[model samples]
Target: MTGQGSHPRHGLVDVIHAPVRLSIVAALAGLEKAEFRFLRDTIEVSDSLLSKHLTTLEAAGYVQIVKAGTGRRPRTWVSLTPAGRTAFDAYTESLKKIIDAGN
Candidate 1:
């Protein structure tokens, strides 16, 4: 058994565990990609807030961010990396384990 207070095997992933980041990952998990504005609105966060978390996720190699211009203005899109998808899957499985233990 692990020492007291030590993380369980397959414990929650720290980087993607944050509420906002979790929501972001969950949202992207089902899609090929999502527009920045769509995520901002769906997650109900400010532009800067979403941008900030996205940057963190990007740095962790969990997500990719792309900026492009269609016409007059630039657009940003976000998607999960393979690593992110794997981590998210693990996270959900860990969550299920925890919930089961509590039952």
Candidate 2:
């Protein structure tokens, strides 16, 4: 994709581009792994909103969700996959280059 200037823009994988998803990924990058509620709170999104973003990330192979326990209060943990880390790094680098060009 192309931006307003001459810079080529990066495309969001099935996982990273959405605002909520991007926030989720950024938060996950800072933690070893995060619980569902932690991510929901960190991203300041509703439970349903977080869940939807997580589902998309999971489907895109960018994140993995582990479900523990078998009852009503099962704990769900989310982590970024190697693919996700690489994608996030690439996105940040691309942004940096764009910023540097304007300097």
Q: lDDT of all predictions, in order shown?
A: 0.91, 0.82
- Model 2 whole-model lDDT (C-alpha atoms): 0.82
lDDT for each residue of candidate 2 in 15-82, tens digit (9 for 90 to 100): 57678888999999888899998888877989888988888988888889998976778989999999
Question: What does candidate 1's lDDT look like per residue over 32-102, in tens digits?
Answer: 99999999999999999998999999999999999999999899999999999999998998888787777
The regions of model 2 sitting more than 4 angstroms off are: 1-6, 11-14, 70-72
On a 0 to 100 scale, what is the lDDT of residue 53 in model 1? 96
**Could you tell me the TM-score of candidate 1?**
0.90
* Best-performing candidate as measured by lDDT: 1
Q: Which residue pairs collide in model 1, if any? A: none
- Residue range with the least summed lDDT across 10 consecutive positions in model 1: 1-10
